[model samples]
Target chain A: MSRRPPVGVLAMAGVAIGVLGLPLVGLLQRTPWSSLGATLGEAATLEALRVSAVVSLAAAAVSVMLGLPLAWVLARLPFRGRALVRAVVLLPMVLPPVVGGIALFFALGRRGLIGRALQNGFGVDTLIGTTAGAVIAAAFVAMPFFVITAEAGLRQLDPRLESAAATLGAGRWTVLRRITLPLLAPSLAAGATLSWARALGEFGATITFAGNHPGRTRTLPLAIAQANEAGQPEAAIAMSVLLIAVSLVVLVGLRHRWLAPRRRWPEPSQEIPSP
Target chain B: MSIHAEIQATVGGFAIRAAFDAPAGTCTAVVGPNGAGKTTLIHALAGLVALERGKIVLAGQVVDDPARRRRVPPERRPIALHSQHNLLFPHLSVADNVAFGPRCSGLAARAARRRAEEWLEKVGLAEAAGLRPAQLSGGQAQRAGLARAAACQPEVLLLDESLAALDAETRTDVRHLLADLSATRVLITHDPVEARLLADQLLVMETGEIVQAGAPEEVAANPRTPWTAGLLGVNLLSGRAAGTEVALDCGLALTTATPMTGPVLVAFSPAAVTLSTAEPHTSARNTWEAEVGRVQPEGDRVKVFLGPPAPCRVWVTPQAVGELGLEAGSRCWASLKATELTVRQA
Candidate 1:
């Protein structure tokens, strides 16, 4: 609606665009193209990539599956200490990932609460140094994203929908599956994407819980870190390129389909009746 | 054992105690002012709210009763309620929201979807089947809601101010649809006009009590209470007319524009009449010199009802009554403006 911008506005725009675009520009410039082919051919690199994919996908699925019910409970049910329960779910989001890792290690490392029971019953000594451990750690940090977003979706849903479904003869469970879930799908998709992204980026928690084991739990991020530690800058940069390229593709596609524009339902328009 | 039931429940801070016998075909309207618990009564009857101290018995099933500890959850209740809020599901297509209950009732998925399509056609929303609720207009949404309720085909239909949200024109259409699809309908409303247009009987609620209940004509004919008269806007007559003003047999004279040949209603506002103790001559169209039959305090004003035959009434300030030393049998002159008078056809 405005006709023109002031000189200050132009200056601010220049600064903002420069700040926003600098990282992508630098990544493209710094990408080691010649070394990319050789580094990608490395068996360790391919194995690490496979491990990352499996761990991140498993973590995303677990997060969504668990977070949905937790979100519904927090948003819809009334109980004593509900606020406390909600706070517990949200703790991972606020805690530093390293602290999250330490917390995970204490619980699922050999002597932890359920860890002891698992060892006694199933003879599973610990969750550390395994692909499942990396997934558990990744899921721990990623689940909060799903819970918070899904809870917002559940909170915003009108109860009338369920009521209307009932009048048409829907029982509670039927309404939930047929009416409630589909209605909340966009939010669910958004939450799933957030969890996926978070899981893919998991470094500290995976390192602490699963350790860096090639072909087992050493994901792309761990591989890149190991390359850097070994002073193989070329290999690290090549893997970084692949990581950036793939993550960008996943992020863009998920965003375009689920997290993009038009997902935000417009507010009901109020048309003033003519007097 | 009948479809009708006694409904009692408390919601928020309000309590509802009503014995409603919704006959097989008649539409019973629960008409009351705002906050009169009409909707609560409807919800209680629909099993939406738990009873603090009553029961809803329908077709021999004690759906809800606090004392007997018999309560059917809303989902299990045989009755259907089209909620006042036009609650269409925003995410699902129009067809899916309608199909919800049947599928929930254990119908196969295909059968449920078919029933949903049939109801959509019935509500004239078949064209919008693929669209979400956010796509429908107000009336369409309302129709969809009704379609969803009717699709279940429950024994008792409880509409809780269902038409209150629609525009005037759409309301007429929905009301027509409702009348055609009529079952044992318990309609909750605040508008007497809507009540008269839609219902065979009226249940008037005042505060938490049922002040009056009967046919609309009967209730309109002899309003047992003053609130009922005000709500129905009927000429409440308990007096006789003489000349330009009718004197209520209750000792109150009402001025009217039409000259009464015999018995008539001389209607005028309480504000139109000037009350004075002195019988001074004035240009007022009707001047009534009557002894104060009774002086009752109403808010800041006192309603003065004069003697029978010329039974006339006027409202004067409490301060004025005190200053004039007004009491029963005290002589007073009342004057009313001709422009302020209204005549009923009857």
Candidate 2:
């Protein structure tokens, strides 16, 4: 604690902080404090907020409904090409969002491969330019976050606990519901929050796949982009501030799990103090 | 219910081939060194580990028979395994942890919790029912794990070193509780005293094989292997006996009470060996000059390990250790009476 760090390291750290903090400072400075309430309470802004909430919540729900089983398979099973399967699952996270939107467009766009069958067989037109398409675009990029977090949680758990449950007469589903899921609550919360946050801020994919239709497919991020293009910088800044606040709350809520040092598995000899 | 198992399984290239039986309401303790496949044997009986080629019959029902291609998964088997770490679920309260088995067995939640409370009361953990497993002490947690296993009313209960992690006093209390349980039990342990106190039958394993199985007193009195001898705090010597004289494999001859004209095993308690600073002219026929290898303190007695020509352990009082000036690398004479040796066919 007494030793001083090198000047070069301190200088670079300051630069890194500035790079991250300056935009937040700029957003706050540009916010129309006097008009904030009016801007936020507008019907258009409220509608976009509703759409954003629905899309993000729906994306998180879909992630949990599908990601848990995939996570279990990846963490517990032994098979050939498992690594390849995981890489494919995580591909959306690293691929450019625009490229993901393009891929979704080809598969689910009007007159596309499955999209054409969906229209002709069910009389349901294209999924593109729809709220459902917006959810798909957001989920494509957000689900990997849930899967990776849940998989890590599963791996960190002691397999012996599951074996103990089984020997105690717990069938597979019972063990999963009563033991695995309860133990995994913290990880599930963190993963779902991350997925929701990512979906709320989705831009390129939603715009390319769902299009920017006000009160329908236009979420808060799309609304903000449209405000900037329509010469309403004050409205855009207010929405950006709202998004930043939401993200900050999420980060604060998850600080212990993400920012703290890694927690070690509990040893049998480690005695936890009774509450 | 009784348990009869002939298990042959290969795990991580280590082969295990063992067979044993525990009659109804009896407890069998398996004692062995590390990597001796004791845990593997219990896992096979609990149906956690599949038997490569074997048969397991619990309560007159075949739970596993590889020849018949019939295998019951662990959840369906009427057996419960209490592992070394207890492994109580951290998220559940102690009572809920205990009730898990009963609930899994189709009891309603309220009824299962009632059964859990009953078992908890029996284990003397009734007061801590609402506390989480992580909040309990090690001994309390172990009791909760035991209650959880027994609450299901399984026919066979497998305990894998369940008491190995407890303090001395807690271990004794838990041992009493274990002895009171009515299920047919198979206990894997490293403690000779625990085996002798709680087990009706003793099984000694080495290198994945059950080397000896019999009454606890019988196995402890005549251990077939050095590992078993060490566990029981005795010296095991292999030799060929002719009449009362036996030629030890380590190039020493000993006079014993029992004699045979073939290969044999001679076991002697360390307490039977008396160490002296000088050669003694005594009635004990087995006396030899040897260098001390290691000296370890066990309770109030000092265990002196003698080196070849007849390597054996000699238990001497601390006062005697001072009188003889015994320590590692010191020379002493160890003398044992002929009647102290137990000779059995190898």
Candidate 3:
């Protein structure tokens, strides 16, 4: 409604836009157009793409499996130290990624607490320098996003609907599967997409916890870093463009699901005849 | 199925203590003012709210008895609650929402849907089976919700102000449908007419307790509380009676035909009052000069509320109101005959 913004606000807004848009423009300008397809089609680059897809998708799956129950507990349960638990859940988002990686390394590295038990009892070694380790690292850093989004969605739902379902003979599991989850589909999709995006771009944790190895732990971001170190800036920029395109397509494809305002079911009018 | 409950529960520091029973295949209407714990009682019966100390038996099963540490979760209880606002699931079509209960009861999907269609037909919503809940009108949505609850075939059905949000025509239609349902029902409503129409027994609740319970006509004819009298459109006054002369609690005295002693409730119809601009010396034993409060028009009669020392409602014809020049804030003399007053123990 306020079509005429102040001149000062407009000037500051332009600066904010430049801050976000300039990097994309710079990346586009540095892109090597003529050999872009050749760089992307290279065997190493294709392998990195496949690895990135597998790791990020698997991380998303893990996030849902773990985050949903955590979200439900946070949204529906009341207990002492709940805030502390939520803070712990959110710690990885704000904590430095390398710090998270170092923490994971200490907890699950060879001769570490659980790692020592696995080796002694189950003949299993550390979860390091493998695609599974990369997935663990990425999921550790990205799952909080899923938990926060899904918890907020759960908070927005009407608990009375669940009660209505219960009175109509829906047990806990049936209510969750038929009513609660269906109503939460949009939030689940949004959370999964966000965590997937975060996983695809993960660098510090993956490199620190799961050492970069070609065709295994070397995802798109790790491969791009390697290409830069090897002085192939053209290949790095090409892969970077590919990553940006994939992220943009996914975000746009699911725009309506996550970006729209929340909607509640229409209820009957509240007015009643006075007693 | 019959329902017998003696519920004592505390919710948010407010305590509700009530005991009532509905015979098999009968309708019991709980009527009360706002904040009277009517909805809480309904929730307790449906097993949605825990009873701090009480027992609830539906048909013959003991659904809740906190004293014995026995409880039946709402899903396992043989009771369905049609809460205010219908609360139909927004994610499913009308038929699917109705079928949800049957599916949860272990009926196959196809069989559940057929049961849903049958209930929808009974409620006159058969054609809306495939439509979404949001697409239906308010009345249609209410009927659909009723159908959904009834489709489950619960022994006890709880309706919390089911017709309160509907228009007059829709209310009458739903009322008829409620009357036709075979399940034992416990309906919570604030409208006296609604209670009188659909219930075989009426329970009046006040301040989280059932103040009175009896046949609808019996309660209406001799209301125990002023609020109940107001709902029934009758005038009631509390007084201490000494023979035929009753001294009202509001510092007014009235003469009645029957002699009574101790504290009493004097009941009379608003039509028994005659309003005049000048004091009248007639056969009427009670006369008072009071200022008019609110003048509301009912069907063919105008209802007038008189203000303090003896505040009461009086119904008069439009012609009398015109001739007496009655309006709010005007002074008038209201008179009633001694025989018109019915004095009973308070």
Candidate 4:
């Protein structure tokens, strides 16, 4: 409750700020401010932006649709090997993006494992080297972020709320729709936004698995990489600034509204006091 | 509606087996110590827990039977469990939380809200219905929880220690409110006073079994177990009975108006015993010579603990204690009428 900050904590805080802020500062310093609009309006850049928006939104949707039930199972249900299943769900979060991409490639690429089985048995094409493949790769890398965040939120919820609802004549599905989901809305939104941001910036996995193409799988990050490799440094710097600005707007804006506890009421005793 | 249930279940290593029948429109209080499977029994009746073996019949309908392999989920049961903590939905206003049950039952939104408002008025929390649960006081929130549970008009209401968490003043207020309800209720409580005040019949549980069951006064006057005796704050002396006299284990004989045979439990209120400094020559059926072990003031009266012929406690007025100058080491004769001792076959 005191305002005094220890010297050691202040020093560590300074280090954290430096580590987090220094890269953005350098990127902003190196950006081509005058040519930003023209560069962003170019054909290749616009195509990549459109593809990035579609793929990232799709990935975020997939994460939320699949992650919510998985999160509920992880947080509320008791079963054998739950820890092992949770570990597997989180593996992609810690895995290198390129390694994840390579793994996805082998599993879904043409002539690889299940990919070949599908081509021979069902006459269906592989997911690799397409926009759908890009979405999958992005989802594979970003889903762990959604699952872990949503699970933590679900774990913090009061389970008695659901039980209370059930006793009040609401069945299992009704209780979930009316009570559990409403309570988890904020965390679910935050997790989806985080997943979207991660998917938007995905480079290694998307390129390795989807094989960046001009009008198909080439997302914003892939286009930026191409610009850098082709010696168009100014275009790459401009895109980096755009990505940083988008991430900041999303993460900071949501954190302020949905995550922070609203302090409108003056009475402190009214929050049930946790026990 | 009457509830007839025989629940058998095991959780972890703790096993519980109990059966009870509540007559139509009667309030039955299940009174017990903690870990006595009171909550477990309530859950079993609510269909939240499975029965290993038994049958549950409610209003002449079979709700649970292990042999038939039929089980009803909690949501399908015509019962409600109200608890002290309220467990109100945090994201919804008080009105919405109360209306939730009716809405789930397929009522129109306006009608459900009207029902919630009516129940809120009954609980005297109508003014707070628009506010969230967190905005209400502890007593007010519990009232809302009651309204929420009652709005659905279930066949049976189960109160699971719903008034235990309140402070003394609020507990009294809530208990008084509960007394006004005319529903078929099964109240689980540890307090004998609450059980006595609210229940038409009393069911006493000890270690997952129904140790005693009868009318409140009957059970209170004839507690056969130590836990029930302690709960009722009465003196219980176990002994062998022959006709109207009990040869107590403490080397004394007590005469009772009721005839008993074989093993018996003798119970008498502390207030029934009168202390005398001199040996009484009165027509009292029983008299014991006791040494005053401790004399402590209790409000307007004094509680005098006596050395055993049986661990006896006597409550006397402060004036009487002072008139006799009673204290530790003081010797006296404790006498009671034959009708005061309740003799029950054990």
Candidate 5:
């Protein structure tokens, strides 16, 4: 409210700033910018970037398809076990990615419960070590980002607008399609962007559930781990820098996209003389 | 279309039982203090809230009948609601927001836009068609909301303090706009003045029951409850009435123009009471020696509170106040014509 914050708050804010900025500073210091091009020019680095783009985009798409309805249910619908449902939906956000990957393996891997059933009954192509499997693993750890953001958006939605729409003769589905979803565009965009970023950085889950099969399942994060283990630290650092840069650009771009509608739409513009 | 509703429902811990009717083309106003179930009644009509008992018949069709296990959802009902907060869709352009209803009703997009523009021009907001609801001032936004609702052409229009949220200037403008609407209307408000200005029929509620319902002037002149009296800003007295004379509970007897027997409520405006330092020999039907309980300035006039701790109030010019030398402890005679007093069954 005031120009200057209190001394205690300023000191705490400085500590918070350090906590967030120190890691980026460390990354920059170790970036190996001079050899960044040569390091990233390796076939493995380009393959990982390609696989990361494919798998993360797929994961992001899948997360939105599944997360939106769940978000709406959590935010708007009143039903028994809603709290439990929400908790289960958000569990992956808190659970270690490795644990989530293991859980996904149990649920979908060959010889696992549903996986065994599908293999026996339908001779279905297995998800294990496949590109699709990598996408599933990434989504398992990332969908909560989309769901939580979208749920917050749905919660902020004013019910009166929907009521006004209904009274105007919109059926339930029409109101959702015409009014609710259009209004929730900002939140959906932000959520999908977060999900995509999280999926791009997914490593523990992809490595455990999808396996680190180069070109098939080795996303950028998994590739970084492999590069470090294979004694190519410079390549790992270069890829890490690339990943950070790409994510920064995406985040900045998405922020503009997310905020543009609200600002450019000029809601509540300065009170003009009434016409 | 006529709206006949007898609603009996309970929300949370409050019990609501109210019944009223508005014939086609008549504007019926439901007015009461806050939490008196005015909005609940509107919700019931809109089918937003279900009735535990009774039935709602709109245009001779039974929209809600709990006994028959039939209920029409809000969207299916031919009713629209407008509240104080002009809840136009914040994201949509003004034209799109207005076009939304007609489009939903199976109109072609072009036709819907035409209908929206027509209503916009009618509400004097045609120039604002391209603007978002947020771009408009409060008054402009409310006018857009009105156009949006009217464009739906619902059988009944439910207004829940629709004009009450605007600034006085905006309220007057919107109120005039509301008056121009010819749909069968139900206006819910707490302002007695707005009710009188807009309503042909007035229904007064108290603790979720219709305590009074009649023509606005008749209801204002003969308010039976102190809550309504307070809202109407009138002096209300409870007493036993025998013929033209009523003995007030405060030991003051007054004669009224109306001749009614049994218990009655006697109401008169504060401006009707004249205060004098001496017992003036006038043709006033009732005169009482009263003490000035308190003196407070009311704009260009002074409101002299008369007691036994505010049995009545009198408004006189500051000059009259100065001439009469009225103050907190001043003893004075309060007089009024019998014709000014309104007596009604309590």
Candidate 6:
């Protein structure tokens, strides 16, 4: 009842430290204290581990590359349908992970929208049971992270820099590469990290659409799910630990060491810092 | 290098209509109060904003004209702007930020960096080449911003409040730097002192329209409108002239050095007049008696407005105000030297 401990403040602090912190603490505590090396040395475990790394990295890269143009349009352009477009782009952010998987299946499955057209045009089939499918699914859930981060970065920038460049005789592509891209670096790094974390832990979407296949579409999350179903709860816990470790290393590196060092340095703070 | 433009632009809730002939190497100061569309005028000319009507001719190239179906985007225009915020790429070092303009302009990267170093050195910022904008002082950032704008070697430089964001100390130094910069410059500023120091001509605006424009001296000596008169620090008296002088119905005669023989515009600054409470015995040329209606304290001086016997204004220092023991409603006499009086036919 003290004035310092407002009800809402206590509730928020309780939720932040209790709910989010407990799982992270338990995962670290139960991470196979004795058999970590043996679990890591298993062929299946290592394969799942490699798949998670490659697929997540690939998905993060693809999301960053593709999300950039969409983010630019949303953040920079003043088109009539911009509001609607932004809402549509943000759908994956709020959509249930399972629902997102179902939607992905409808678009990229063997009998789905793009699957039929791609097959007819190029005599190709959807790699739904392969490694690429895992990447596609991971990208699906994670793409919104990159787009949202990049769009926010773009929104904070002054388009006048590009305009000034244009007046200096630079074309659109030149301005985008030299001005917008460099300016968006910190946001881009954060976005890439977020998407990577999301992709590494993708389960529902990868299972429903990519169809879990060992050495192919099956990722670390699927391995963990399968291990738990087979009554190996400890192994599931271990794989989850591995996944969380990867996320922590990557996310912390990006946010602290890679993206934030130069920013925290105090240099040319003017009459006003950026509003 | 030269630009002649007549453009009318309407954006959202505001519209700007401006026309000016900027000869190469002449910096024109477009001076106005806040929200008077000075920035919009520069943007339209730079092709940053589209014109609703009229043409923009830069070095004989038709940059934009809605009627002619010609619109060159800003990137294609031979111009550069030092933005108000400096907009120094926070991620890049001072050298890199300056190099960006030239590199974007298609100069080879190494060549662009070399040019950037040269410009940075010119702007007195070569020592800070490796430093980020956050590391530079406000004045250093301002210099770097100018160096970056000049690195592109723009034919027309539009400075949109480039120095306004700097602190007073930094702003004073940048003002001198801008004065020495030789380019086809257009400065959009709220400071009359800036306009006087940097521009060869002044264009004054109010509510997005040009109210008056001319050489600073001309505008100061003879302003046609109330807004321009206020801007140029002159008291404008519009009246029908019959001979060497025009008599105000307030019963005071406003004398001019040149005999204005017909309807005319006459102006004089308060600073040019001498004030007294006595009828002068000597020939002080133009003397008038009027009741002091208001005494406005301006800096160290007081501007005393005379309501009647004849409405006129006289300026004296606070020391003089106390020495004369002047007050509102106190009867006073004022004088204008005949030579200081300026007249022009309206």
Which candidate number would show the highest lDDT if scored against the true structure?
Answer: 3
For model 5, the local distance difference test gives: 0.87
Report lDDT per candidate.
Answer: 0.77, 0.89, 0.90, 0.86, 0.87, 0.80
Task: Give TM per candidate.
Answer: 0.78, 0.93, 0.94, 0.91, 0.90, 0.85
**Which sections of candidate 6 miss by over 4 Å?**
A1-16, A23-31, A254-263, A267-275, B104-127, B136-140, B161-182, B189-199, B211-213, B242-263, B279-319, B326-331, B337-339
lDDT of 3 by residue, B128-229 (tens): 887788878777788888888988988788998888767777678778988988889999888889999999999999999999999998888899988999
DockQ of candidate 3 compared with the true complex: 0.52
| Evaluation by DockQ, superior candidate among 2 and 4 | 2
Clashing pairs in 2: none
Clashing residue pairs in all predictions, respectively, total 15, 0, 0, 0, 1, 8
Q: Is candidate 1 or candidate 5 better by lDDT?
A: 5
Give Cα distance to truth, residue A133, candidate 5, Å. Answer: 1.5
Residues B1-346, candidate 6: write the lDDT tens digits. Answer: 7889897998777998888888888889887778888888988988878999989998899999899799988877888888776878777788988998888777898999999999887666777888888887666777788889878888889988777656666567667777776678988876667777788888887788887878888777777776677666677776767767787545567766677676776778878878787987656578877778889997677888878655556778898898777898887677777777677887
* Of 3 and 4, the candidate ranking higher by TM-score: 3
TM-score of model 4 (CA atoms): 0.91
Where does candidate 2 stray beyond 4 Å?
Answer: A1-8, A261-275, B107-130
Q: Candidate 3: where is the Cα deviation over 4 Å?
A: A262-275, B106-130
Interface RMSD of each: 5.5, 5.2, 6.3, 5.3, 2.2, 5.8
> Which pairs clash in the backbone of model 5?
A268-B134
Ordering by DockQ: 5, 2, 3, 4, 6, 1
- Deviation in Å, model 1, residue B325 alpha carbon: 37
For model 6 chain B, give the 10-residue run with minimal summed lDDT.
Answer: B248-257
The ten-residue window of minimal lDDT in model 5 chain B covers: B162-171
Which candidate, 3 or 5, has the higher DockQ? 5
